[model samples]
Target: MIKTKCFFCKKSYTIDYSDSQYQKIKANPKAYYVCKKCNESMQREAQSTTGLDMDVIDKYDKFLR
Candidate 1:
């Protein structure tokens, strides 16, 4: 089990290697793992914001390239 701390909420959680892509994440320094509650709240906040969703825009741009 790998113990991880949520960057947003400062919560400590454990990741089971069998259930999560722990090794892949460990290989990438830029990769992050957030708690489910924090992730859901962030998504909700993003949806409520005005203007284009930068996350979607970035994906679309990548798709076009």
Candidate 2:
């Protein structure tokens, strides 16, 4: 499993998705992973880099985040 930092607190954790998490995501094409603390920070970063407002940031961050 790969290690990634939590978007919320930036704490690192390895992905340990169960079969159910996989199936849930697979069944729902719109589902995605979120780094708890990093999400909002990352979203702002994307917006600054791309010249988008918060609304656009949220909309596009779904794809980029």
- Whose lDDT is greatest here? 1
In candidate 2, list every pair of residues with a backbone clash.
7-35, 7-36, 7-37, 7-38, 8-36, 8-37
At residue 5, candidate 1 shows an lDDT of 76
Q: Which ten residues in a row have the lowest lDDT in candidate 1?
A: 56-65
lDDT of each structure?
A: 0.67, 0.56
How does residue 50 of candidate 1 score in lDDT?
56
lDDT of 1 by residue, 1-65 (tens): 77777778988777776634467557763467777788768866886785556567577644432
List candidate 1 segments past 4 Å from native.
18-21, 28-31, 51-65
Worst 10 residues of 2 by lDDT: 16-25
Clashes of 2: 6
Each prediction's TM-score versus the true structure: 0.57, 0.36
